[model samples]
Target: GEAGRAAALEGLERKVKAAMRSTTLNRLAPDLEALVRAETIAVQAGPRPSADESVLAEIRGAVLAGRPLSFIYSRPGAEARSRSVAPCGVMFGRANYLVAADRESGRIQTFRLDRMTSVEAGDGLATPPADFDLAAFASQSFGIYQDEIEDVVLRVTPQGATEARGWRWHPTQTLEDQPDGSVVVRFRASGMRELAWHLFSWGEQVTIEAPQRLKAVMAGELAAAGRALSRAQS
Candidate 1:
């Protein structure tokens, strides 16, 4: 199984290298020229989020040039507003986000690429803080949206311990085997809403032991589901 996965990764890497050689991709990411020429393997799961190619090109160019960006960002149920930020980096997961710092507040924020309009690069140069590490910043959250970080603990029943042991929950997660044959999973992260969404799939196999916020979020989801089922029955 491990060998098959390795082969698949290698094949994907070859395909990516081939794709990066295209005129369009090369133009969009000239900084990646050296990277594409190097040997590397990368594999990702889940559906890739889609965004405007022109918007992505603009962001990439700004990031490469260490320039600030101006755009109009709109969130659901909120009025669109203009924003100016120094481009830090872009993170691609189930959704693509521009992780940038607010020009006025100097506070870091994430804006979905799909939600941005009228994207323009600023004239003045800007860059991330000297101590800023993209990987470290990304690891602070369970998902893309960052909030208050909390110590999360999950207890997996004996029936699910085997599966849990093999799963990588988070980069900072540690697994502890219990005398009762169960497993305790612990990590520090944010994005309780996303965590609650994932825990729904586990049914009763997993139980949250800390972070009242996550427990409350899970309860709220359960109550909402109950209400929806009641409405359906009527």
Candidate 2:
């Protein structure tokens, strides 16, 4: 996809160059030269296509047209597999495409565009709920897959909060200062794996404030990791 987008940009650059070359009139030389330089610079600065544009285009068209699109897609750290999906919509964020698919499982499945290949659109269509909003859907998500929605509150130490303030992991993140040199972040999200992983990276600087289930899971994971390390040395 990156290659395809880059190639498309390159094609535009060539056209601009050809136009500049074809226009030999000295009267418009100054403006044409400036335009040519600008085009060249823009082309150079454009992001390289890391995804297949055709796949993106086809998927997007199908979603908007209310048709089912099929493709070979893979999850993070997974092998690509063929999937037929009734796409509710397409979302672009976190440098990946999030597609809502209707399946026997009530939870929606998210797909990474870079992992998709040979995407095709089918004629069958399904209208998504009028209330469905992709942006709102991803407001609290860290990556793609959203399984179970819940309100997750986290208390970050002042130092941790300071580090988190500059970066936005979720759009719905709400921050509040704490007296004990910490901050509380309140947000609603479904998938917590990525966030759990992020919290683990912070060590003990942050603490889970709500949803005892997640906190317990996180604690268990850390405890198991500690035991694994202890066993390795013993």
lDDT per residue as tens, model 2, 1-234: 357667889999778767774555555779868997888432433223245667777877887788777778766787778887777766654456646656445346677777777788887665555567767776646656566677888887777878866657576778888788788888878667667767887877778887776787687788888999999999
Displacement of residue 197 (Cα, Å) in model 2 is 1.0
- Worst 10 contiguous positions by lDDT, candidate 1: 1-10
| Top lDDT prediction, candidate number | 1
The models' CA-based lDDT, in order, is 0.87, 0.71
Can you write out model 1's per-residue Cα lDDT over 1-234, one digit (the tens) per residue?
A: 234446668999779878675786657676676777886757656545655667877888999999989999999999999988999988877888999987766777899887899999889987877787889999989999889999999999999999999998999999999999999999999999889988998999999998899999999999999999999999
| Clash pairs, model 1 backbone | none
Q: What is the lDDT, from 0 to 100, of the residue 95 in candidate 1?
A: 82
The whole-model C-alpha lDDT of candidate 1 against the native structure comes to 0.87
RMSD in order of candidates: 9.4, 6.5
* Cα lDDT, model 1, residue 127: 80
lDDT of 2 at 217: 69
